[model samples]
Target: MDHDAISIDGGTAADRHARPGAAGAGGANDLLAHFSDPHSVARYAEGPPRFVPGFTDLHRMTRLLLTERAPDDARVLVLGAGGGLELKAFAEAEPHWTFDGVDPAAEMLGLAGRTLGPLAARVRLHQGYIDDAPEGPFDAATCLLTLHFLAPDERRRTAAEIRRRLKPGAPFVAAHSSFPQDDGERALWLSRYAAFAVASGADPDQARTARAAIDTRLNLLSPAHDEAILRDAGFSNVSLFYAAFTWRGWVAYA
Candidate 1:
């Protein structure tokens, strides 16, 4: 199956706000609207769920942690857990681990609960941004795809928060869609895609504007920068475990 084309089972608020013309009157409002959209659930329910190859790396990372018996008794935090598909997988794979999923989108959380049903009971769902996440010292944490929505500073702050919430030697995995390292390639693709988006009837200007907005709102940390952020956050051992085109994944020990 085409995993990349397979959408998550639920839609978070961010999906709606990002839709053309549905954006709210202001920046914060637009952000909030997109973050709260409930369509993510519908998308997931429409078909069988499967992890993208990149996400499989996340599962592998978790498995490695389990093999090493990294704080299995500690509470797990899934930042931007979306519809809880990963939570379901983790819960099933390691029932000994309890989970607390935090996402700013209510619709996404609701979908997560519905998708997992009784299994979902093991998770404590929180509706809030990763930056504003409640108290932690979690045994481990995972943030996927969602990081692409923040700017540099926000990404740093969020990483710092994740670090603070982790127990010593705890594992933290953060993934994002990276910009191409080669300046020429990056510029060429952006120029080509910008034209393609416009040719496809999307407002080229709006699309460009939205791209900037996303860059400002999300932190699509480059592989090198991502490692640096983790190391700076006090994570001792950090390395990139996976990459697929723009998407990259990291595994770190706090």
Candidate 2:
């Protein structure tokens, strides 16, 4: 199946991580603390049916987006490259594509280093945010399941930073969790997500806990809100290519 052409139904998926914290500081501290554990990093790299909810398909969507939008020899910027899943996949898909994998966590970068294996040398792993990443007028970039951790201001900052790093007319693909505008829709969406967790292997209590964390911690935005943020950050011709309940994916020109 050309997963790229597959239309989303009601099914949804997300990149799972523990909440960052109050303001952005709390989240940064939480991330640093979370990446401190080797076991945690290992579990995260393993994907669903073992460690957390999302895995293969989410990364697959990212891959599909890049394949469709990025040039064959694209210089790609992978933001928040926890385990290098997208980096490895992209390198394998288009061997000529060089990558810069950026993440603030050393252990996660280390896991990414291991995941990249032979391609490790091809990818330049940076232990920082987009600002600390190597200078790049990259051909394309991806920030999947990473931005929802940022506060609104931080998200704008991130968007602007990414815009600064990419060449004009470059394609940037991103996926994030979103909330509904209507109270009824919001309740229904949350309930469906909680049920998806159970179906994806979480116990009911575990699902509830996960749902609570998402509701209380993650900085999910509505689709319109996301488009506004992108446009305000300087991306033009922004268009959403995929949607599955709370999870949304878009491609915008930098």
Candidate 3:
């Protein structure tokens, strides 16, 4: 299956299979260490739904947007696909669709394999960052709940790489930590994010810790800046498709 992946050896594909400075898998040492733990990987499924508003809906909406322009037997590229929640959801929604999922967290990828079960046959789990992804003219792609892990520069490079791998006009759906960039507004929204998590039954202390990690460790940006990065990466007709409190999702065409 590795033979199916294209070898893009240009300057664009930086750091051979090395993890980026992303949050969960690629951010602070403590956080990345957390992700690498078998215990944390075992409990990964519980965190997103609690911290991210409408986690299930996010997957559904991603499938819908991707299928808007994707073929029935679409070959999709999924970045930061460590948990396999979205992969499982997408696979269940469209049996014919195949996926190439990339992430730096080996343990999380193992958990993804378990989460996928029999569905793993339809997906190739690449253990690396976006640049390590298959150089495909994929039917569609998604980078959900992952970009905030990367700094703005790395984020832009990653987006451009995803664009380059896509078929012309292919839809690329991305969702991450995008909120008001102002100092006061950022703090306010982060507080609300923590409140939402607590409201959703997250332990208050854990929620506070997660909120703090997001604020200090994740490289967040404004929705407008996020859109600009996509546009700068050569994506067209970018539009916001989901806005659940601190998170924002957008669908763009490559």
2 or 3, which is superior by TM-score?
3
Deviation in Å, model 3, residue 86 alpha carbon:
0.3
| Better by lDDT, candidate 2 or 1 | 2
Which ten contiguous residues of candidate 3 have the minimum total lDDT?
1-10
- TM-score per prediction, in order, is 0.71, 0.81, 0.90
Ranking by TM-score: 3, 2, 1
What residue pairs clash in candidate 2, if any at all?
Answer: 20-27, 21-27
Better of 2 and 3 by lDDT: 3
Clashes of each: 18, 2, 5
Query: For model 3, what is the error of residue 216's alpha carbon versus the real structure, in angstroms, after optimal superposition?
Result: 0.8
lDDT of 2 by residue, 76-150 (tens): 888878677777877877888988887766667777777777776578777666666666888888897778777
lDDT of 3: 0.84
**Candidate 1 local distance difference test against the native:** 0.63
In the range 1-254, model 1's lDDT, one tens digit per residue, is: 11122223334455544544222234544555554555635664332212233454566665566336356565888887766777787887776778878776666676777766667657777666664465687888888766656555556667788888888888887776665646576555445444544554556675586456543444344577767777776777787776654557778877
- Candidate 1 all-Cα RMSD: 8.1
Could you tell me how far off, in angstroms, the CA of residue 142 lies in candidate 2 after the best superposition?
0.4
lDDT of 3 at 239: 97
